[model samples]
Target: MLLCWRDVLLPEGEHVTEKVVRSSTMMRVVIVEDEGITRKWIKKKIEDLGMGFVVEGVFSNGSQALEYMNSHDTDVVFTDIQMPVMDGLELLEQIQAMEKQPYKVILSAYDEFCYARRAMKLGAQEFVLKPEITEESLRSILEEARKFQDQRNTLDQERLKSEGESWEASMRQLIRRAGDPDDIELIRQLEEQGIFLSFPDMILVDIFFDGVIRKKLALELLNLFLEQEQTKGTAFSCSEQEFVIFYAYEDHENSLKQVQKLRKVLKSHMGVEVYLGVSRRKQDCGWGKMYRQASMACENRRFFSIPGCQSYESMRITAEGNPSEFCFFQNIKQIGVFLGQRQYTEAQIAVERLLEAVGEAVYLYPAYVKTMCNEFLVLYLHEIWKYDLTEEEKGGTGAVELLFEQAASHFHLLKEDVLKAVSYMTQLLKRKSGINGCSAPVQEIIKYIEEHYAERISLAQISDSIYLSQSYASTLFKKETGKKFSSYLQEVRLEKSCEMLLDSRISIQEIAVRTGFFDAAHFSRVFKEWYGLSPAEYRKRIILQKGNRIIQ
Candidate 1:
């Protein structure tokens, strides 16, 4: 018998085989043999040897093996030499032609020695004879093949590591070159590489770390952020212990909101403290302005004194107005600052004080009170919207509703009454503002006119009610509401005239006195301007429309 062993077989197979096979750390294997009985025997032997190989796949013939290889991945392949149409040699050739080839072994009968030799030349890892195969021989061959696979894997891993380092270096170079450029050429490059970079605005985030480990943790946290598809425009670079990220968003305020969200993500995920800064640019401003604003925002992070976001908008002091009248504005500003600092309790107290102050101001200036209240309501709603309440918590009845109720009660403004009043005011302002060449003061004058329209009224009387100089109010009322004060009062009087006209029992002369018109002729002229008909003609048209509806 000519004894042929591809690699040295283990001499003490019974002693070391079980220990090696039972070990947790071992490579996986696949077996391809045409003979079902032989395949079963081989599988049994592999398991019995207690070697650590996990047989992930077993196929009957070479064609089936090839099909399996195409769809599945394995660490090692065990193939029969002389099976059917697509034999071990053809399968080996196919694997070698692939972009990433797997390790291979040949198992054949003694008569196939010549074929096995050819397989070796074609990069078959090792060959084993079937009939005389022993546990010892199998273990040694697998050991040698495992060693070769480890060496190849190490080389491949090193190549990948080198490529990753080069790619990271390229990203840093692109970021550095992007500085001071009129447009970001790197964005075009990234897009060409199938990465998107367009955003309505960009926010630069700089995270400073105290130690190397914390710095790496920060970078990892930012990597998690990039995984979100909505954050595609974001890019990051790390230098030593500092990580800089450029986050892109559609809105300027949205970028600031993202920074606030990032702080919570960092604290919860990484257990690391970080300071964030944001700056925004308009969509048309180009990348140059974006980079400058972001850089400035990052530089300002040092002044925050704690982990938080510093934005360009947060730094400026708003211009002050009358000290006593605008005291509530100052209080709201302080409340906003407290909210920015994450001091919810202090912020709520400030909001309460602002509500109280506005209440006093409204009592002192009842004529202009609605305007003041409307402005404060807008501010209060905006701040409430800014609170970090979840969607579910804010739905139906929640903190927002409670705060609104508090605001109404504090100002002694009835909810139903205020809503009705605001609706009327909004309609009057909408019409007045939409008219050609209307001034803001005209809406105020119109408001005054409506309140006193049922009383004895004149342009001078209406102007005095709202405390505007009569001539100024008169000119503004005409410009804004698109009608002279006298004409607007006449229209109001004529509309009331129509309501009385509908009564059928009331005389036209009595309607004139009731709606603030001087006499029936004056009411007729005004009603004619308003309805394009005299009062009697207007009453007849209404009567005809109503009678026809009743008949139908």
Candidate 2:
């Protein structure tokens, strides 16, 4: 009655083990035996054991079984030794080398005790003789394997959970670092990372949320505005109470227009009242300037201002101004203080009053007003150019007159620049208007020319791409952009040729071809006209300048 394994086996004369049993909870198992009849018999016996065990697969040879085991998730493997190719011993060795080896039971007909001992040494879970293949023996081995699988599964889940927690913690740390402090050093670091930060005339908007979760929502809304498709060169920061946004653009009026669009989006989406103040751009502008502007814009929002935004320009300058008598310096300082303190409403009121006074002055003293406005605009633009300078010339000269000259020429070539500026200002004042007024089609024409300047692209090709008649496109383009299409294209090509001349490594002929010129001789003629020097002379001058730097 002791139920010994050997006593349960059928006589040696029988080819198959005749044990009929079944289990409800099937434990996954793999049988790797070369003999088909023996493998089938063993599988049937395993299924007969009502202890809930299921055979997942049966491989005819040890090699095939090893390949299946390498890719599969099996609880137990029953393999026979002494096979023709890749014996169970070899398969056991391979399994032991795996990172997570399966529980293994060796099934053999040979009464080789030595083989059993070897299997045990190779980490085999159990060794069973073919004649002693009884349900009791099978049950013992499966129970042990299932226990091992459960432990491993628990460990795997714990490991995955830990990794998830660690990743989340790292993200939280990064967010904290970004929020720790707002200062010049931080802004400079961001700039070094290729985030543009320069605003000569900035309107700072401090958006505060009333509800507990509203602040977070407002911050998200502000960030979305900065990343809007139509808005470019925008930066922002979020703190507990406020979110500050800075807008930098080539044209101040255009920037304000974009901000107005953002204001409308926020009002429609969030249903929260947001205050804004505009600050004049400082000579030394960075995070400090941004903070100052936002503070001022917020302060200016208090004086019966609309729910959205206001600009410093709207506050100080009037269409009817005797420009000479306007106190530009005093108004600038007052607006600066309003922004610095986040007094947006006060700033708006002050700016509006100042603008009215300036408007009166403009009519009384038109010439003086023109001079003052030009001087202020130029000074503001020059400060911005300093931020755009290359790293090597951080502290180098920033000449306003030179930038003004460039702007004048640029405006002459692109007559729509002033119109675009005007349209942008109008859009800003009218919040509901979207940014569809700019001559985007003309801009597309300019962009295409710049990109294909190295190729021999023609006006006909560009006109077709922009969907305009060639003659009409040429005439309209010239009228809107000030320069003839052909002239602009030529200027772009010549500018590229001049840059190539500085390289010295490129031959004149190669430069000519690269810059879309027909031949080197023709290229030389255009180069001389543009720069008053041949390609070789330009190269010589660049080399001399480099040599002087090295000597110094």
Candidate 3:
């Protein structure tokens, strides 16, 4: 009954011919031969196959085999073509129709090759003629079937992995806009594509950046940080300068340790200042709200001059929720009006009132306090521009970053900067108006100077226009306007130059020519003499200042 498979050897160095099957994988088998002797022999052969094959049943007809398989599972079904009741083909169909189809092998005589081919087309794994059936042939067939199943399992695993990745991506999106019905619907659709997510109570950690970092690099670092803490967390980019991490609420102590690890890694490895705002654990549709709380907490950390974690719950008690009680917006608007009117004293008084109101409203949220300060500074800058102040008098708006930092330690520094702007504008206004009450001829001279200051002019030219001698015209112009002819014209041209510097992005060289300077270097020299800053410096200072001055 056995054929020698001399070339085959098992992993244990046993001869493949010594056993009908050599694999460790136990394959349940059934026999459906109509001949009693052949069915008995097949069953005995499977039994002799040793470890891998188990002869589950021996049937005289395909009907009995199918009936046996109805309740019991078989890994491989071997059926003879000729049967009394249901033929092997019908039995193969019924077996293949089962929820889990077994590996089918058809047993046929040499003359039943056509039947074997038909059975193979019906999802049978192999066909073995009765005369050629051998230990080697049956074992090879079973080995081939095992390989196929292994490959299928691998493919299934790969598919599962791909689905897991898709699920994670969808979860990130869902968490970002959590509580939104549309996003929740999107999550359901994503589940159809692969895996499903049920959100547990979670905490949001918002990381704010003080400097620039590439998004890809930041994400990688964040992942590494999570790995170091052995924490399972999800991170997504929030903005150009911020990122957010969401971790399931496991334990408060462990979560705090994760935050500390992240902060340390960001500082030691990335050389960056990071502030983390942690929100309390929230479940269901509160992810978006939790994000806002964490963001507010993180932003407020800047007020302490320290880089560390801030918890939203810690600050909730102090936030008054009524920002209007302080009248910050009203006093800020009044101060702007007074500055526009060149009422330095009145603007100072309004500023004092605003500060006093702020002091009294110490119960306000830290976010509101920072926002009020920024609005006040922006409004003051806008008003300074209205008074025709030079860029040097504006103290360069880039300094606002420093001022904000200082306000954390010394709030008075901001007040001093604002008052300095007020005084600078007032002094500039008084000097510009020294010729306000000049005589009619002097007024006429001033008017001509204003209209034609861009062009070449001299005291002689002015006196000729007025029908007076040059020497007498000079004395009269000085006595009435309190400025010599050349000094007055220089003042008018410099003032025009300052206006162009603040309001326009035109080239400095073109500005010099338009402002009646012979060349850029000469114009810069005169500008530096008057404003204590070169033309380039003045433009940079004002541009920086204006950029930071957002309307409240």
Candidate 4:
């Protein structure tokens, strides 16, 4: 209708026309029509309605309108379909390809109405008959265009805001250096960039995520936790699967309970465990120490047996005295010997012991475990590569790289990788040799020696098990393994007795009986002859060398 309902209140000639009647769109318009009179009439009707909408340019055909509009910015286009040179439909289609297109309206007569459908498909926002072009009709279309523009503008602003926030979060992560948070210049830069803590005393929470998350989904989950009215803190992603949060230290107990609730919620919904480490409330800017403390707290979760948040005060460092990690190393070395002897069962048993050490040595740093696993693999590959392995057995550096990556992610993966690597070596050795370790006869002979090394064993006893003549069996064993039967038996007995000597529980006489020696005198003589020391002397010297007495 009209601008304001002041028609009844004001005199007849007095009007609130142009100022109040129009929409607030202020949308610029371009008109193209073959009929000059109709183009003038439409322009006049829009002007009569109000100045809130401006007709930027008017043309007799679509081609002229297209050229003028190309160099200018226009918000809307009104065109007639039956124009000369270029039709309204063509102009509408051309405008569709522009980077910033205007709202489109079509002016059509009854006969030309068939093309209106095609024009609308070409991106016309409204279509009106020439005879029906009224101020009300014009205002209706302008208001619709205005509403659409408002919505688009709002979305654009929101997108910009989201991007800027993401960029700021990324910058915060880069600015805060681990173990070096006190750099004056860096701190000043961070503060200048508005990355400082909001309170002097704040609790830092370090978070570690699993891996990837859908950005929108992650944001939705994150907003639920951060935007809670009871929680006053800021959280930002440090990297994929990792984030950090800072809470104004209000109450120590409250902070812990608050973040713990966040962790539980995230874990329950995200289907992944989340760790929240709370640092001892310190001066807010002293985040270097706080960051380290907070990180150390969460690291407690590295042991799968331990779950939930840990605070800075609860962090403990493993001491260096009497580490059972030594026992782990000793067991690791035994694996190679078992594999060489074709004792896959014993080799795997040794592997299980190493993994047990990994699980129990929670006091030890992860790097220590990672190093032990790496050394074990490196030593294994070095030992096996010395043999003329088949092409398949030489697994190359793929396993090496894989183990390294597994160590970085989680120590549990190291167990799996070690098994696979060892299995590959087992396959390699199996292929290089025969079924188990070597020829079937040789394998049986070695098995018999190790099983009964503490008993009175003879070559004839081994031959009977593998169904070979004693002389032939001895020769086959020597040929395949490069050690004579008697020599192999003596080596096994000496190795066993030496290990027992380290334990003071076994007596000299008992050692002889346990190792299948004929007597104490014979055992001492043979042990001295082979090892360059008598049993008692060897035990004393080893204890001295280790700087500790051998205990039961």
Candidate 5:
């Protein structure tokens, strides 16, 4: 009625009992009897009881049953003492030597009480003299085995837990991490035939999860898998949702497949997607460097938009070249021209094309994407700001920083942000311009500029007076005059200055002040640049020419 477990008191005054059976599974039975009729009859009785025992193998001799049980799982072995080649007692001894020995039971039809005592001494759970064995007795034996297995499993788990803590403490001496168990959990040190990894020859794998999960359950499942696979490595929790695995140098191909299988196991158990980052063994690479590389690869999955895995060696990196130096200056220049001419659609297209080109690049390095987007943004801001003649834009930073807030590390997000910003700039330019045209609006801008030439005129002031936006006023004036608004205004100021100079009554300083040249020095500089003579020299020469013509 009870499992044959002889308990001994431990130092803590607790009794350590029997071992081996999963109570949840049906108890497996192997019957070994020399008489075929007795073996069949006993097997029929046990199976007919409908108890939690299933007769897996029925053998004519102990040797046959032992061979089967060695390779297969046999929770309970029912054998007769007398058989050919191998007898029941010898079989029980051999089963005891096996790693996972099943519960032993001796079966005999004869009244050999001595054989029963010998089988009990040899660690047999029950000795059944056949013809006396009944269904109720078999049920009691099955229930006892299940109960003992459950108790043993509990003790084993407790032992493993205590040992696991000691293992973690030992690992702490090796890894200098911030003292948070959720941040770092050191597992047992895995030992194998040949693995010290003294040289720089270990592949580090980092696992990343998107959100929080129960780390204890997750990591235990991973540990069980590693044990079953006979994988030798040091594993630890890097964070609540991230783990690290270090393997001695095997080829990356095998390591990759193994890691992929690990991923599958985790997914099957937890129903969560795991992103992986792997680091290869490189020359002179130390632990800190490798850890950083694996961490970088893991985090970069989001920016790079790769869902599964990324290895450091797989990334295309040109060590000598600078990613920030990747240029799209010509596109930037063309965009400026488009904005200046009120080509909003063209400007938008240019922006999209530029970003598309960046996206089309062979390798999307996170740093390069960031650098390229930043450069594109700055250059584009400066470019488009040229066309925005609003008084505020002229004085302020002109959306360089306002648009920069949208910058992101993700390629698609960055591209979307850049396109939106460019589109915004385009719309703003268009709104300021009011309408894109070559005729009436341009003539209005021209008249306004000509009339206001003498009194510190600017496109912003002129556009305000004429009820037009600064951007539209400037663009329209350029289209009408085949020159920029500033150049035309300067020419108008100089023409007025020249007319004043012909009178000779006004001093150069007075002429400069009246014509909005700011000073006589400015007047002279403009005159020399345009006509190769200073203002004073030009005035004297003109007077001399007039006098000679009058005398003639």
Candidate 6:
């Protein structure tokens, strides 16, 4: 019958030979079958055809074929219906899901034609029955697949031209703008461009670097690392200073290591401080939330975190219940007290602990934490305003507030900037004291008080330091400064003690000893008399204000 068919027709026309020449170039093929003999037979037959299709790979099952597909550019996949590990249907589904979908064909027995139909529905272009697998039948399927590949290649080129503009905008809207993923118009547009997201969970990794990063170098590093990990993640430069990668949560840990390594390599090679933030493995269309978590964690640069790598899981604060409101309120109040007493060091310490506590509260109670931080900022500003400050000092206060406002979601950075503002305020106070209208003797006395406030300062010692009798030095101090020697000394001592309470986490008893109080009990009594709270109570109040102020 074969000889008779060959004798029945003769090819004619230039188009016939041209077509044959065109189809002669090899098309890369991968064959998947559970039976080794059948797989080898199919591979050899495709190679022997000496036409367009050539078997580049032969796998005993679909899983192996899928692995090969990861690194190799496969033009067509010819797979059997049933196989171990991954079935032909599963392979076809994944291939269709790929950004560059390959042509698929099915080989099945007549009894399994129903499965072949399902495979066709899953994006298989053709099916060849096993018993009828002749050279002619095989060539017919391959020719059809080649045509399908040509059509797809043309469409892909057109898509690429528009995809950069359209899909990038769509991605920015979805991930950066927090646009609704369920928006009908958005879904329609993305579908038109064949951008589909099937996974319910996503892992977001944000990269941050100081100064401008070369985009070409940055993308080169990202692609190298992702390809090495064999990840299907997508990345884009969100801004000049930031780049973000979105990967499946199924490969979260592996992707995480890849991103971390990418961070280090960029730093070592580029000589830039590159930081990475990894979001918690989250479910649903959580790209925005994960982006914030990862980016902020990297930006925070907290003490407990390594500057180059921080994960949301590592930086997140966990509380079994809401932190005590009384604690947070007390801390804020203590910060006020420290500021009022001109103890900026202590104020800075109190603010640090306070921010850390609120940082933990942010996840469970965002609104509450925001209110407390704002209120605390107001308190800090009020305390600084009590003194006559220059315009520069006033501007410093405004800058601190602005910094806090900018770091609304990032408590660690807010804490650092606030501390710097308070320190600047303290310097202003010191300068103000220096230019006071007090006489030289009194100015010397004030200097002595500042330097020796933490020592066993006595009137005899104060006068002796300047070679004057106690009574004469006392009169000179009062006449010049309007405050008596003992009163001025007490004021200086108490102020210094308040500074110690705020600046250090030392025990109150130890603080009393260091700050020149012979008796811890007496120090607490005096501290209460001045600030209306014991030292220990003040410290606890500063650290525990997160829950209390929020509740109020």
Please give the TM-score that candidate 1 achieves against the real structure.
Answer: 0.28
TM-score of each: 0.28, 0.26, 0.43, 0.38, 0.42, 0.39
User: RMSD, each candidate, Å?
Assistant: 33.0, 32.7, 33.3, 31.0, 35.9, 30.0
**Model 4 lDDT on a 0 to 1 scale:** 0.65
Q: Looking at model 6, report the run of 10 residues with the lowest lDDT sum.
A: 1-10
Candidate 1 lDDT score relative to the true structure:
0.57
**Of 3 and 6, the candidate ranking higher by lDDT:** 3
Misplaced by over 4 Å in model 6 are 1-170, 183-196, 249-255, 286-289, 301-306, 313-330, 336-377, 380-552
Question: Candidates 1 and 5: which is better by TM-score?
Answer: 5
For residues 1-552, write the lDDT of model 1, one tens digit per residue: 111111111211111113222243466677887766677677787878766776666776677666556534566788987776688888888888655466787888856667877898888877777876788887887787678878876886687677775444555545533533344556665565445544445556665443344555666778678676266544454455455666556664466667788778876765556556555644454444444354444433432224566664443211234423333445645655664454545654565565455443321222123333344344434444443332432441232232221212112433233433333333322333343234546655555555556578677766776778888887777666667888877666665466579777889888888888888898888778767899899889978976663333
- Global lDDT of each candidate: 0.57, 0.57, 0.65, 0.65, 0.64, 0.64
For residues 1-552, could you state the per-residue lDDT of candidate 5 as single tens digits? 121112221111222344433234677888887665676677888888877787777766666666666545677778888887798889888888775567777877778788878787888988877777777877777777767666765775687677775544444333433222223222213333233545345777778776667788776877776677665556777556777777665455687777777777777776777778888766755454566567667756756555577776655423225543224545656776776566778878887887877665433455545555555456545545554354433433343453332224456756655665665555545534542334666655655554566678777876777788888777767765678987877876776666567768889999888888888898889879988989898899878976663333
Residue pairs clashing in model 5 are none
Superposed Cα deviation of residue 463, candidate 1 (Å): 99
> TM-score winner among the candidates?
3
Clashes of each: 4, 48, 1, 1, 0, 14
Alpha-carbon runs more than 4 Å astray in model 3:
1-165, 180-202, 208-242, 248-261, 281-285, 292-324, 327-448, 459-481, 495-512, 518-552
Error of 3 at 75 (Å): 58
lDDT of 6 by residue, 1-552 (tens): 001111111111012114322232458888887665577677777878877676666776677677667545688888998887798888888787565677787888766667867987998887777888887887787788788888986886677667765555456545653424455654555455443455555567788776666887886777676667664566777666678876654554575676667778889766777767777554454455567677666654422233566766653222345532332656777877776676766777787777766654533223234445566666666655665554545665655654432313334444555555666556545545543667766667777765666678888887788888999989888887677887777766676565566654577888787777777898899889988998888877765763453332
Error of model 2, residue 209, in angstroms: 52
The TM-score between candidate 5 and the true structure equals 0.42
lDDT of each residue in 427-520, candidate 4, tens digit only: 4444344425587677667666656888898999878877889989877888877788888789878876876787788899999999999999
